[model samples]
Target: MPTSSSSPPTDSPTTGGHRFHALRVVIPALIILVWLAGAGIGGPYFGKVSEVSSNDSTAFLPTSAEATTVQNRLPDFLGEDAIPAIVLITSQQKLDSADLADIRTLAQDLAGLPEVAGAVSPPIPSEDGLAVQIFVPLDADSEVDAAVEALRAELAATLPGGLTSYVTGPAGFAGDLVEAFGGIDGLLLLVAVIAVFLILVVVYRSPLLPIIVLVTSTFALCVALLTVWWLAKAGIVLLSGQTQGILFILVIGAATDYALLYVSRYRETLRDHDTRWAATKAAWRGSIAAITASGGTVIAGLLCLLLSDLQSNRSLGPIASIGIVFAMASALTLLPSLLMAFGRSAFWPRRPQPIGDDVDPQVAHLPARGVWARLPRYVARHARPIWIVVTLALLAGTLGLTQLEAKGVPQSDLVLGSSEARDGQAALGQHFPGGSGSPAYVIADEGELQDVTDALLGTEGVASVAVTAADSPSGTAPVTADGVQPIGPPGTPAPDPTVDDGDVLLQATLAYPADSAAAEDVIRQLRSDLGDRAAIGGPTATDLDSNNASIRDRTLIIPIVLLVILVILMLLLRAVVAPVLLIGTVVLSFAATLGISALVFDHVFDLPGADPAVPLFGFVFLVALGIDYNIFLMTRVREEALHHGAREGMNRGLAITGGVITSAGLVLAATFAALAVIPIMFLLQLAFIVAFGVLIDTLLVRSVLVPALGHELGRHLWWPSRRIAAASDPAPAAVRADTADR
Candidate 1:
């Protein structure tokens, strides 16, 4: 096995080398200045994201979905773009005439609010007479959160004594969603940056180095967001609060990870090279392939979302891919420049001194004696046993995968923290039909309107059915077995049903909460019964369609992502066996992550349930990002193995790469963990899954299992490749002279 020599080689600087040396200082300075200007320009866009982004669930549905079709036709039926807010006023005692009068006054006052789209519904007493429900239509395009808050404040100030009120419906949910994501721009970014900074500080034990790394990541995120914001503004892609938050974290974590790899190479090169320019050149060469391959793999996996049936997933593909592009660019350019400018001082008190340049041999060539050193020895000594035990343990964890319930969760439970919308949903179910404000919308041929209405009314979960009417005072006329009912007195003429393109709209109030599983089941049954004859849509249908689409996306995209990543790995490692081995370990790590997360979610946190997309996203992130560490480790191993035999290379590679890879893992894990503070269930679940998966990948799979398995396989690990023989071949004259000197 090749070992480090006491002597070092002198560079014979040609004219090209001299020109390259001059360019390094000038080029890095230019790169740093450009990034600083970009960060300054892009940082303020964080607060303006809401201007270009949406949280509306309906907007994210597939265009072909029933919900999307209904959503598009809604404005035509209603005469305006609006979202209903159901206000439930409840009292322990039956309301008297004065109470009814007060409720009427409250409704009248709500109608006067600027955001109120039309006349607010008069108080309609429940069958028990202890509760009254009022429907308020708020302009969907307005500031929904502010409008909801206004409604809540007005109700609180003017409600009759001993009565409780809640604002719950589509608008209410939108308001809650906006509130839940309110922290994405500030708290999420702050938490992620702080977490990464702390981890970097611990790893590097340097003040300036962590800042430099963080600046690189922050600059990448700022530029990515700036580009994404404009793209969203131009309507090229849908930007939601969910995607924005994810982009922020993905950029920061990925950039920092890439920065860590570069830093490690730079530090190693500094120990050998006296000049910062030479060290930077060598480090950039060593790190570029691994970093580029890792970033490309993640981008490819994310872009696979374009094939998803859900717009939310499809939009995230390009949005996050853009972020990854910036991350890679910044890591390859900006971070390198920063580290080169700082040079050895970037390591501070622990700065690496050049070997054999007035340094003690004992201090310079001190053999690694930490856990990193011992870990390689352990892997070499017990290769088979270690891999077998780790594999068995990972497989055992997969058993818990069956316990994961990822069909979907109720919209009321979408936000983990306290929510007025969720509370109002509970109150709404208690007083009136659970789907009072939000009704299941159906569009059918005018000829079959009555038939579709009958089908909907006959459905088990349907409370009442009404048809959109042009002349009705309330915008909808009641639908009965006979026909559309009169809006007012018996003598009043029945309003004609609204018709557009020979289709009439029907609204069916659900007997259960609009976001409940029972409502979704009813929607599914209706779709099954009606087929393409009628398009059924609403909040319930939207959830149902989204869940179905997510399931489909998981089935289709997961395999494609795996295949794409495997090919990238093959090209990267230049060997079939090594890439397959790396991919297998990452897959096992992902399963273990999900399995353990399933147990934790079900038993520990006791979450209601997860979105169907959770597992799919977890798999994509874990496998792609998890494979990142393996790529870092294995690429170095392959490089070392080409000089030293496979066994010796594995030992040296694991030992040398251990600390940086672990730190990178921790940094990535910490940035993801910051998602927990967002207060949204999907993000929270994703945070845990990816964060846990990364830790498992770094600590167990990459650190122990992979190295052990590679050692067990020996040179055959590079099957079909005779590159392993290069370790035994004599060096060329130039290399021999360099080796003799070094």
Candidate 2:
């Protein structure tokens, strides 16, 4: 490296006066204290996240959807809106009179609870006489999970022996979803931190280094949570368990990835600089560009979700973007301060050797011996063959994309592992109409009520239809093509259908399971027949609308994200071809990840299907994160090419940036893998896809494929850039010899 002076600068610790030295120490301490205070204040917000967050799918459905329209009109016709929970009690043998009486008593007790809304239905017997089902109206505004737990506990305490019970319905499934995400606050964070820590220990082979990196990540997450929690509490944005979990993982992974880059640069600078101040300055100056650009790309990609119709996706865009911003800030500010405070001792026994003023900064980055060093030479020679083979292999991975199914998993399948709601759903389906508790809400004008009711009744999958009747003994009265059925003797009159603002409400019980594709099909068919005559909304319709919204979002957002990232790369690298090539490779690698993940999900895990948001989330994370490695490598390659020629620069940059980029990728993948501990299918699938995709990015694409392509393209990789175009020519003899020596 060229030295501007024979000694350290005046601002550096060694040459600075007492006052200047004091400034350096106090500044770093102040930065540390500020972060510590922020983290301390933010830590408690983790437990409080659930207070402002919701797992209700209907709450996030596209407002323009028919389901949302019907949902809005429901409360006006049906009094206060409520969620239905089916209490299913089954026995091996036929239920006797005493058994039925006990079940009714239990139902009465459940009805008396504060969680129950309006009136609870009388126990209805099944055709086999082996099962009794009770429909309980749960207060939708209250905590569904806690209410379900209370109901379950009550049943466990009072129900007679030989009777088995399950609470299943929209309310029950919602409860299950809340319980599944219960781990996000504690277990998910712990697992992700532990996983990243272990990987960091292996990568750095130092005790304190991993802890320092984790501290930065954790602090970033803490502050991000604090910001998001308040925003959610103020109703500025929606918060959900899924988005919160993603925020946790994204902050940790992104912060740590940026930290690794800084550390790598700092280590190099420390070897040639005498003072920690000098090292910190050089390192920060070197790594900040790449770190900020990487974070900005991720933020941009996440923000595209703002265009989504689903509230959950729109919320995630800003929430995760906030996380990325904090992550970058922590890495650039907090981590550097910590490193300055610790100095070289943070590395312990593995401390980098100081080379003093004689060290050549350009050559110091060359790995003495490693796969990274050797692989570059291999790529330089076999550029064409290696890239072609790697391209073909990645393409082969895409073949399984045909098996991928991302329409949407059933509500029961949302939670992985054992699900009481899923079990209850199955039991309820076996004993009664599959859609008993969760009925479809159809809103129509009073003039079209009969037409809409007849259409719903004629629908292939509808089991029963009823109109909301406030005057009836039950909340609803039976309806058919013949209009409302009589409630009593022949002389009694039928209950009048409740109407509000010229619109009436009708409930359709689907013969198929409420969340089944068959049920969704029924809703679609009804909408087609009814057209503007009525609107259909229910648990199934909410799910259907959410899925449709996700599909629309992914279709629109994917291309926009690609365009955003492509433009960012062009600006960052000042080259069109390099960004396009890098984008192509990452896109292929992402496809491969999805393809392989599909096979694993289908054949190994036997999962039902994926939520529509999986591919979109995976794409946002993998493509943005995967490009980070490219930025790290290409930035250095472009820097080296300015002096060393294209061939020499490609080899040198590949060899030099390889270790740090690989380590960064590993940390990111490991942190994302921790998402699997949450027991949510969406998180699990995303975990696998991103983790696997990142490895492919670091190991194969960045390590071999990009290098080979860059080598073959040579100086042309930086086309339209006058600087790189000039540097692509043959280097001087001395420069070639210096490169050869490394």
Candidate 3:
């Protein structure tokens, strides 16, 4: 007769079912809000300012002894945004007095632009033989492209029929990018559609599947791009044309992959249970391990870019990481909900396989059974030998990784041309007696600057020397019989100007190609020989500086990422032994990936070594993805052990989860392979490395190596876990019972 008389029924739905029902609505709504905020609010947050500099002169001045010290440490110093733009000057005819007037007028107009640091045009011929050169300075903050466009517009408006004028340099390159955007975007879009269509069709074997994937992918990608654009506006990241060109394809490719993995599983489970809620739960349970693992891998790889020497590379990591994470969440939340909503119809008109045909009854009551059910039992039967063979093979492949070198040609090898920059490079070589890819300035200012100039001029690799700070080029404009006569050729034999009296800018033209081995060697020698005279400055030196800086970044980042993943896995497993084995296997997968990549690049792709950054990139991807497989397999193994014992648990874990992880790996690998078809060499290498790594991680490491190790370890795999240790007796019984059901 107490208060218990009015108690409600003891049994309602399980707490888990209620929680799942609530999350099915709430979590998705929250995810949608996050998605919108990231896409809509984050898009314009980056690139709000072109450069950050103060009006204070000393703020721009180099005052600290640490300034020079830091400058010497890498390719260039931080806070030194002194990348000078070149305007390659060309003439259709000799400089007549009329043409000279037009050129000077245009130069003066260009000089007025905010970003024109300086421009110099060689003096008009003093004699009939004197050569002509022009140079102009531009605003420090404004990009070269805008200045070039303004000047081009001016030239079109004012230049008379007597001559033609054009500007090509960094500004010119920027100008060209703006002009070429339409064409590039069209090409990229075409490529993305074709690639996405092909990949989805191959994986799903249904036209509807591909269409569904594309629509969902496009929605997610638009959101990611919008987010990136907003982030750029916020000053959080920089969005360049290169970033834009790659974003759509990358997002589509990555998100479709995650969706494909999750949705495919949901379809299989739906066919089995014929209940949307049960299928959703089963697919989520089956795929959570794989999704978490692979997503972690991608995130780790992208984060590795943060250690890059190039500001562009560093910025890209966080930006790409955001998209990857968003895609992952969409796969986990949005995708699962969509699968629930679609019910059995998603696989329709293509009839789902009958439950009896696909289901293995022997293992159904045992809580784990499926093709994967047989794997652990087989591995345990021959665990010792299988482990020995895999370990030996992986160790043997590890040797090839040592031969992998990081070296490559300059980026000019990658940039497109008929591009004015490319044309200018070629024309400069033809017109200027010797090649002038870009001139490097070696200015030494220990006060006795004249001696430093002489020292540099005396160096063996030095081609020609000029001191521009003194005696700015001055000559009488050409004269005609009445008002003007035509001038000589653009770079004809010209009168030499005398050096300035005091401070001088030593412009040293090197005798080797800017990107050549010889040029790098000369740069190194100059640094060694120029002890106290002055410091070397120029594009070649800058190239070398950036290369070394990148190496430093790689050295720091790779180990740090590996360590981070190791710690993450250890925490997840709550066991030191599990993390250690997992890391070891991942390392082996990476080695195999690198060894195979070296073979492909050396023999298949055929370039000098791989890209300079490939090792860093490959390390990032391989370790990240490799750990993903480990996570999936281990999580299931732990789940199985909790209910069944160690041996049966290992078998059941593989049976239940193996197909899911393998499918995820295949889809992710396929997406990365899409990058290979890109014409760019760096992207191609990245594609091959990632695609191949995922394949190895899935087939060899996850399928064979992990199972072999798990079988060999038995209960010891989860050592120090009293729960696991206590439940060891029934593992073989569970394995046998699960197998009998099949």
Question: Candidate 1 — number of clashing residue pairs?
Answer: 0
Candidate 2 on 1-742: residue-level lDDT in tens? Answer: 4233365422247665899889889988998899899999999998788789998888898779888888877778767678888889999999999988888888889889999888887898999998988888889888889999988998899889999999889888889999999999889988888889888999899999999999999999999999998999999999998998889999999999999999999888777677789888899999989898889988888898899988898999999999999999999999999998888888886876566556666667798787986878777767788999999999999999999999998888888889889999999888888888899988888999888888888878999998888888777889988889978688789999898989888889999899999999998998889888888899989988999999999999999999999999999999999999999999999999999999999999899889989999999999999998898899988888888777788888888899989999998898899999988999999999999999999999999999888877777888888786354455334334544564
Compare candidates 1 and 3 on TM-score and give the better one. Answer: 1
lDDT of 1 by residue, 1-742 (tens): 0022354433322246767867766898999999988888898999899999988998899989878988899888878788899898999999999999989898899899888997677788998888999989998888789889999999999887899998989999999989899999999999999999999999889989999999999999999998998999999999998999899999999999999999988887877676677777888898999998899999999999999999999999999999999999999999888887877777888987667535654234224588986777667777788999999999999999999999999999988879988898887788789899889999999999889988888889999999998678778889988889997877998899999989999999999999999998899899999998899889999999899999999999999999999999888888899889888888888888899999999999899889999998888888989988998998888887887767767877888889999999999999999999999999999999999999999999999999888878888888867887545533333333433453
Please provide, for model 3 over 301-340, each residue's C-alpha lDDT reduced to its tens digit, 9 standing for 90 to 100.
7777776655555666787777777677777776776656
lDDT of 2 at 498: 90
For each candidate, what TM-score against the reference? 0.94, 0.96, 0.73
> Alpha-carbon error at 728 in model 2, in Å?
6.4
Better of 1 and 2 by TM-score: 2
TM-score of decoy 1: 0.94
Give the higher-lDDT candidate: 2 or 3: 2
How much is 91 displaced in model 1, in angstroms? 1.3
Worst 10 residues of 2 by lDDT: 2-11
